[model samples]
Target: MTGKERRARIVELLEGAQAPVSGTALARELGVSRQVIVQDVALLRADGTAVVSTSRGYSLARDARPCRLLKEHHRDDEVADEMYLIVDMGGTIEDTMVNHRTYGQMSAHLGVSSRRDVERFLDDLRSSRSSLLSGITSGYHFHHVRADSEETLDAIEQALREHGWLVPMSDYEREALR
Candidate 1:
């Protein structure tokens, strides 16, 4: 198949998938090298496809939900609590981001929508001895949160605020996010 045809197939596969599709799996299915699948995904992204890369693999971005970017700060010990609260309140923690003085912004896809996902994420961090991206920014970070409606997001925001985890965004952050 042509590159264009392969890319289209990638999109179709992702759209129909219930879970993220790994590049290796895509490559095998498309009869191409993994690098080719990676390049195809890059090209698809450049062409405006909402393909989200998560810890497991790539999936078509879910745009049906309303999302909000929330700035928050908390100690490492509170990570589980924060995640559980969001998921329990019907919000999906899509990703986490931090702005560094030198690097500007860095992010990682979380895809944490349930308690199980949260536990797996924390377990990975422990097993790998990896620090959270927010650690570089002194616990200050941003979360891309998605929920069924504006009201759900608002509830999550309020809960965070009540927990003292919510931080008011700096003017620079506001402008940069815009």
Candidate 2:
């Protein structure tokens, strides 16, 4: 199939998928190498397909929802706890971002919406040599959280505050985000 056709197939697969689909799986199904699938995904993203890559694999971005960018700080060990709290409060952790003095902003798609997702993320972290993105910023980071309604986001924010994880954004961050 042509590159264009392959990309369209990729989008179709992502849209219909119940969970994140791995590049390897897509490559095998499409009779191409994983690198080709990766390149296809990159091209697809450049074209504004909203493909999200998570620890498990790739998926399409969800429909419009109330989202909040929350600044938080915590120890590495508390990662699971924070994630669990957010998911339990009916929030989806869309992504995690950190601002570095040199790097400006760095982020990753989390797609963590359930307890299973949280456990899978932790497992991936534990099995890999890499560490959390927040580590580079000394545990200070921002989570892009989405929920069905503003009330759910408010509840998640309150829970984070109660856990002493929510933090005030710096003036620079506030301006930069805007």
Candidate 3:
């Protein structure tokens, strides 16, 4: 099959999948090398496909409906505040998403729900001497918080906003994306 056709199939397969599908699995299905699959995914993303890379593997971002929520907090509170909020709401921090005015989309895995999960993730980061995006972004960050439903997610957003932890997405900022 041509590269274009193969890329289309890869996107279709990812969108239909409910879970992360490994590059090897995709390569097998497409009768191509895993590297080819990765290249195709990159092309697809460059063309504006919402493909998200998770720790487990790759999945279509649209396949996982992003819960409606907003959170904005100081860089200093990123660890402790995230842990308390996710645990209090009985949800997990699926990912951290940030919109760069000049750079477009950027995100990372957070994958946490409990205090222990938070501690372990933080510990791992420290042990690895790893740095986060915000560390390089002048302390600006955002998140794609997931929960059971819109209501639950909204509740968390509201609480955070009330506590001066979240900043509302202004009409101008929302319009800029369009």
Best by lDDT: 1
Ranking by lDDT, best first?
Answer: 1, 2, 3
lDDT of 2 by residue, 85-139 (tens): 9999999887788889998776677889999999999999989978999999999
> Which candidate number maximizes TM-score?
1
lDDT (Cα, tens digit) per residue for candidate 1, span 1-178: 9888899899999999999999999999999999999988866654435698988999997687887889999999999999999999999998888889988777777889999999999999999999988999999999889899999999999999999999999897875653
Taking the tens digit of each residue's C-alpha lDDT, what string does model 3 give over 1-178?
A: 8887897798888878989999999999989999998888866654445677878779886535444435365665465775577668866675665567777756666667788888887788789988766665565566656677777787877777776767767685444321
Count of clashing residue pairs in every prediction: 0, 0, 0
Error of 1 at 60 (Å): 6.0
Clashing residue pairs found in predicted model 2: none
For each candidate, the alpha-carbon lDDT, in order, equals: 0.88, 0.87, 0.69
For model 3, the run of ten residues with the poorest summed lDDT: 62-71
Clashes of 3: 0
